[model samples]
Target: SDIVTSVLDVSQPCEVNIAIYDISGRCAMERELEIDCRGEVEIELDTGKLSCGVYEVKVLSNAGGDKSRFVVVR
Candidate 1:
């Protein structure tokens, strides 16, 4: 089982867009998240339903955006 964890640093409450893309650039999963002023918040993505392969995680917010790559193997 693989899980995607996103750690965010926020100064105010806001909505965030979290998405996962497969190697072919297809969206595999996505979630709209909410965060408080808490300096760091962690969001978990359940990848149990996805096939084993390379994937990309993207996070979008008013502050900025970030992207990361990951791999799953069973």
Candidate 2:
């Protein structure tokens, strides 16, 4: 499974930091994504070796950031 989110109102092309953490606040995954400044952009998290459980997703950019939770079921 993958974690999907959107980054909107991007003013310029830049790199955004995407991180995923488990319920215990342990960092499970991380990635640096290069995105184009469109009206709205869809970002998908590469689950990789993540296990099935509840996790939090954080997307941070120079513009702003957001946090949310998702479940990865195998």
Output the number of the lDDT-best candidate. Answer: 1
lDDT tens digits, residue span 1-74, model 2: 36456444566887889889999999998888888665677776677578889999888888888888888887
Point to the candidate with the largest TM-score. 1
Candidate 1 residue-wise lDDT, 9-44, digit = tens: 877788899999999999999899878666888888
Instruction: List lDDT for all candidates, in order.
Output: 0.87, 0.79
Residues forming the 10-long window of minimal summed lDDT in candidate 2: 1-10
* Residue 65 displacement (Å), model 2: 0.9
| lDDT, model 1, position 12 | 78
Clash count for each candidate, listed in order shown: 0, 0
Query: Could you estimate the TM-score for every candidate?
Result: 0.90, 0.79
RMSD of candidates 1 onward, in order = 1.2, 2.1
Error of 1 at 46 (Å): 0.3
**Candidate 1 lDDT trough over 10 residues, lowest sum:** 1-10
